[model samples]
Target: MEEPVRWGVLATGKIAESFARELREVPGARLVAVGSRTQASADRFAAAYGGRPHGTYRALVEDPEVEVVYVATPHALHLEDTRMALEAGKHVLCEKPLTLNLSEAETLVALASTRGLFLMEAMWMACHPVVRAVADGLRSGRFGAPRQLHADLGFVVQVPPEHRLRDPALGAGALLDMGVYPLTLADLLLGPATEVRATAVLDERGVDVDVAVAARHGEAVSVSTASMTSASPRTASLATDTGRIDLPGDFHHPAYAVWTPVGGEPERIDPPEPVLGSGLGNEAAEVGRCVREGLGESPWVPHARSLRVMQLMDDVRRQIGVRYGADAAGVAT
Candidate 1:
């Protein structure tokens, strides 16, 4: 039997917890350790998830037993944390948005390339079965040339201003936090966006609360919306010249998809595998497979794709005037 890939989780936030819960679902994957800013937090998380707790992020990356570290830190810390892990000679899978902007993302990608280590942005949606099926179908002309698309993800966050979703320093914004889903879906279904136009409502903290973006990819056009102050359908659709594919609610982690060919009845495609704690296991498994194959990046979510997504997000933010301090404090020269 193949050896289980040892995993180290950085941060003890909700996302981290979810990743840990889902990690068990992947074959040949193991959660060996966890790191947090505080020993108390690490201990608490480790007790629940079954991993050795480290008091600091540095300690966790430095551990000789861990093969790869999942950087689950907030958006603002992704670059710093991923760089730190790569420098420590450990492979990394950082959470999405990857970094606050494209510049930071490029730096990390170059670092991982230089170190010849595995690195991937945790964009689980791209690894999802339904999304993969749709991507394959699109590539094979299952849905004739996509003509237009619309995707949205939103939820009402009734939290204090200090909440991460509302705090600028944490890279809080509808675009970064929630919008990436729809934007990524569009990119996957259509192609790289050739033009983008965006408008947003920024809160007192200078972070976007609601955002809408329209982008053109070749002859195809897409509309993406995200919000923190309101509820949206949390769905996505691709209208092709010959048919349309309707992704179920929370399109990012959809349970099923409906493909309607022109003049034909809709077909239901159920998810192929049971998702663990929101389908994160799929991405985790992809990372493990890439690492085991001695590959530095997963073909499913390549570094180039990640950089492109960051670049598009940067453009959207520029139009919306939402900037995180990290934009000015890039980690790489």
Candidate 2:
């Protein structure tokens, strides 16, 4: 409702810090407060972004000066935090995988609709110009219809078994963390998958460390593999009937992508003018643009689309037997 959208951050983790730094760089975005479980962390993050410190999420959400809340908590906590922010009558921008399951995601969508609130999932890559160009090209009939897709996102999960990546309580695994990006990419372009046949490498702790999923969208198929045990970095590529789109290392961040047509030289494309700078701030820009336009969600990463992706993730969990402690305790879906 103001020149700069007042942002109330709900965590002090590395992602929270990185996103807050980006918000500072965006012209019409302002970091108003940083909230954490502890006051010290809040103070530190607020100081970093030149904002006030809130000792708890409640304090930040109820702050009159804050227009929106960015939920940067772990995967398992996304549902609860986003619900709290929406209930408080503040717009919410939550992290990916939206929720731990499809049911919770549907609940959030209904709640936002009932409450007249704006909500979005932070699939920042989808908001980038590179991804938009690819989508537009596909719809323009220039790239032709999408046929097959190959995507891989893996990282070396070098942490103790007690860490979140290993802790079932935190909803840790390769599918929810690394796999979401590639799966989302396919969903954004090729559309909803009717079915998925998957296989995975379950670690000794009963957690799936390596997962391979192949989904069918009518005749077109999308395939992806994700791992928490590999030392190799990560990579993602998209192939269409007309040409192939190549994304460099760290595919999530906006970068140079080559569009190679059949038997033709590749052309390079970048983000548009408004978001042409470092891709880090694209999500913040999306939030501001949507709010300015009086829209309830972003076309780039809509809440309904996020819910569909979460269902895919839930299906992946069902295919593999990676149940969290909360699920065991009947607290999760």
Candidate 3:
């Protein structure tokens, strides 16, 4: 049997904890180490998740036993954290929105390519079984030609002003945090976006709290909305020439989808394989497969696709007047 892929998790935040829990469910994967700014935080995570705890990210990435590193820091820290792991000669799976802007994302991708190491954006939704099946069906003409799509995700964020979700320095915003999901879902089901237009409501700090986006992907049009100040259905639906498909609430990691033919009754479509855990583990499984197969990037979450999404978010941010530190440093918005 193939040896399990050894893993190290950097950071001990809520997302990191969630990934740790899901990582446990991925076959051929093992949690070897976890790192945090403080020893207490690392120890706590390790104790709960079964890993060796390191007080510093540097230590965790340098752990000889760790073959792949999962960068679970906030969006603002992804570039640096992922770059560090790549420089240390470890494969990486970084959290979504990849980086603050397209330039930073390019830098990381170039680095990974130069080093010939595996690098992938942790867009868990893209690895979801239900999503893949639906996208495949759409592409294969089993669902007919996709015409239009609409997806929305939102929640009233109840956190202090200093919290990451409300802080500009931390790359906090509804668009980056919640909006990426809807946009990605549309891209997968519709194709690469060719034109994008957006509008948003920003907080006092100039961080977007609510955002709505419309884009044209080939001949199909898609609308996506995300908000941090209100609750939404968090649903997605795709209209095609012959039928329609809908994903209920929490569409990003749905267990199943509903499909209705033009003149046929609605049918439920389940994923081809069992979901690992809360859907996140499926991405872990993808990483393990790629690493063992000596592939530098996951075909399911290609580098080009991740960069395209980042570019779209950049355009949206520019139009909405939400700027990050990278933008000020002359990074293309």
Candidate 4:
């Protein structure tokens, strides 16, 4: 049997833990090391999966036995961690909202291409069975051009000003954290964005608490929204000239989605695997497959698409006055 790819997980945060847990379920993958800011955290994360605990991300990146390093840190740290891995000649799978701003994302993309390494944003949603089904429908014209789409992902969390969700230094805001989901959902079906106009509510700390983004691409239109101070779980739908598809609750990790044609019975889509438990693994599988194929990017969550999404986010931020600290004017340059 072929050897599983040696994976080193960087960071011991919630996303890091979740990705590591999901990696274990993916075949042809093995978690060999974990790196954390603290030795104790690294030890704890590694002990769970029989991996070596490295005291710093550099240690994990430089480990010759590790095939790839997964950067699961906060959005602000994505560029740094991914650069470290690429500099170390290791492939990388960086978490979503790929970078804090478009300039940062552009730099990372150029680096990855120059180094000829496989770099992908862990937009696991694009790899899930339900999401793929939607993509297939749109591509096959089953949904008749999918002229309309509406998706909202928001929740009310007690985020103080100091929390990452509210910290300006961390790119804390609904647009970066929760809004990326709906925005990416728009991109999945709408293709490249031609125009975008949005409005948002700002927090006392100057971060946006909620943002509603309406994007237009020729004849197709998509409204994607998110809020960090409210509860809105019953808001996921896709419409075309033919009909609308209603995704069940928890649209992010849906078990089954219903497609309804114009004045016709609703058809159900049941995915073979229940991605609800650890959907992160699906993207990990994509990374492994791309590596095996010697591809620099996965078609599911390609680096180009991530950059486009970041560009869209850049526009939304400009509209809402919620800019990353350094880029207060939100200049792309």
Index of the highest-lDDT prediction: 3
Relative to the true structure, candidate 1 reaches a TM of: 0.97
Off by over 4 Å in 2: 274-278, 325-333
Model 3, range 1-333, lDDT digits (tens) per residue? 999999999999999999999998999999999999999999999999989999999999999999999999989999999999999999999999899899999999999999999999999999999999998888789999999999999999999988889988898999989999999888878889999999999888898999999999999999999999998899999999999999989999998999999999999999999899989999999999999999999999999989989989988888888888888776534
lDDT of 1 by residue, 108-200 (tens): 999999999999999999999888888998999877999999999999988787778878888888898899989988888888999999999
Candidate 2 lDDT tens digits, 1-333: 368888989989988888888887787888888889999999888777777899898898988998989999988898899999999999989987787777778888888889988889888889887778878888888777788888788888899987768877777889988889889988988999998988899988778899999999887899988989885446667787778888777777647678889899998877555563456588888888898787889999988679888878877777787676545533223
Query: Each prediction's Cα lDDT score?
Result: 0.91, 0.83, 0.93, 0.85
Taking all chains together, each candidate's TM-score versus the true structure is 0.97, 0.94, 0.98, 0.96
On the 0 to 100 scale, the lDDT of residue 149 in model 2 is 80
Clash count in backbone of candidate 2: 0
Q: Once superposed on the true structure, which residue ranges of model 4 sit more than 4 Å away at CA?
A: 272-276, 328-333
Flag regions of model 3 displaced more than 4 Å. none
Which 10-residue window in model 4 sums to the lowest lDDT?
Answer: 324-333
- RMSD to the native, candidate 4? 1.6
- As a whole number from 0 to 100, the lDDT of residue 220 in candidate 1 is 97
Which sequence of candidate numbers ranks them by TM-score, best first? 3, 1, 4, 2
